[model samples]
Each structure stands twice: as C-alpha cells, then as structure tokens.
Target: MQPSPLAAPDASWYDIPGVRLVGAIAGALFLVAAIRAMFGRK
Candidate 1:
C-alpha cells in the first residue's frame, strides 16, 4: 500500500544548494573546534 501524502517523508530540504553549503560550513567549524580542544589550544 502507498503511504498517504502527510505520512510520507519529505527530503526536499536536502535538495537546496544552501543546505549543503551550510552543512559544510558547520562541519568544518566542528572539526576545528574538536582539533583545538584535543591539543589544548585556545
């Protein structure tokens, strides 16, 4: 049976270019923070 429209999952959010851009920026920031914390750098 097919799922109803309201019950279906929407993936349109990932289709936007800005979503990927923001995700990349956030990931980079997280990595930077993690590295800094690991080496005890301010």
Candidate 2:
C-alpha cells in the first residue's frame, strides 16, 4: 500500500525567529479588519 500522502509537519515550521510575532500580530489585525468589514461596522 502507498504511504499516506500527508507527512508530519516540519519541526522547522515553528523555528522562525523574530518575524513570528510580527506575523501573528499582523494576522490578528487582518482578521479583525475582515470581521468588521463583513459586519459593516465602523
């Protein structure tokens, strides 16, 4: 049988330095903006 197509996630995916926090904060802000836009809030 062929092995499962999905392999375990790479450990290095979590090893990024410095930019992780910035990316997370930016992502959160983007989500907030998206939600507000969707709800037509000021």
Candidate 3:
C-alpha cells in the first residue's frame, strides 16, 4: 500500500527559515479566493 502523504506533516514541511510564514500567507490567500468564489457564484 502507498503511504499517506501527510503522515509526518510537521517533519517535512517548511524546514527553511522563512518558508513557514510564506506558506501561511499563501494558504490564507487561497482560502480568501475560495470564499470569494463561493459567494460570488451565487
């Protein structure tokens, strides 16, 4: 069986110094875009 991708999330993600914060910002932007799309398509 194939292993799960998120089995060790903390260990693999954002090992670099400033990458975690950038990831957070990107996530927030994606969420905002998703919400806007959801609301605007009505």
Candidate 4:
C-alpha cells in the first residue's frame, strides 16, 4: 500500500549541512574500521 498524500516522505525536515557532516564522519569511521580489520590490526 502507498502512503497517504499527507504522509508522503519529506526531505526538507533535515538540516542539510549537519546531515552531510554526520554522514561523512560515519562513512569515514566505517572505512577506517574496515581497513583495520582487513589488515588484522587492533
């Protein structure tokens, strides 16, 4: 079933720069962890 018109997803509720920075940091952390695991380092 589809969402109602009043319940449609909205993209304007977020602070763009804040969201981007948080996402970037999380991505970087994930990459670093992956690299460390692959290299068998603590």
Q: What would you estimate as the lDDT of candidate 1?
A: 0.85
- Predicted candidate 2 versus true structure: per-residue lDDT over 1-42, tens digit per residue: 775667555646557676788889999999999998999775
Roughly what TM-score does model 2 have, to 2 decimal places?
0.54
Candidate 3 residue spans exceeding 4 A from truth: 1-13
Model 2 regions more than 4 Å off: 1-16
TM-score of 1: 0.63
Residue lDDT tens for model 3, 1-42: 887985864665567667899988999999999999989686
- Models sorted by lDDT, best on top: 1, 3, 4, 2
The lDDT leader among the candidates is: 1
Report the lDDT of model 3 for residue 32. Answer: 96
Worst 10 residues of 4 by lDDT: 7-16
| TM-score of structure candidate 4 | 0.57
**What local distance difference test score does each model get?**
0.85, 0.79, 0.82, 0.79
The alpha-carbon RMSD values of the candidates against the true structure, listed in the order shown, are 4.1, 6.2, 7.2, 4.5
Q: Write the per-residue lDDT of candidate 1 for residues 1-42, one digit (tens) a residue.
A: 988887537658678679989999999999999988999665
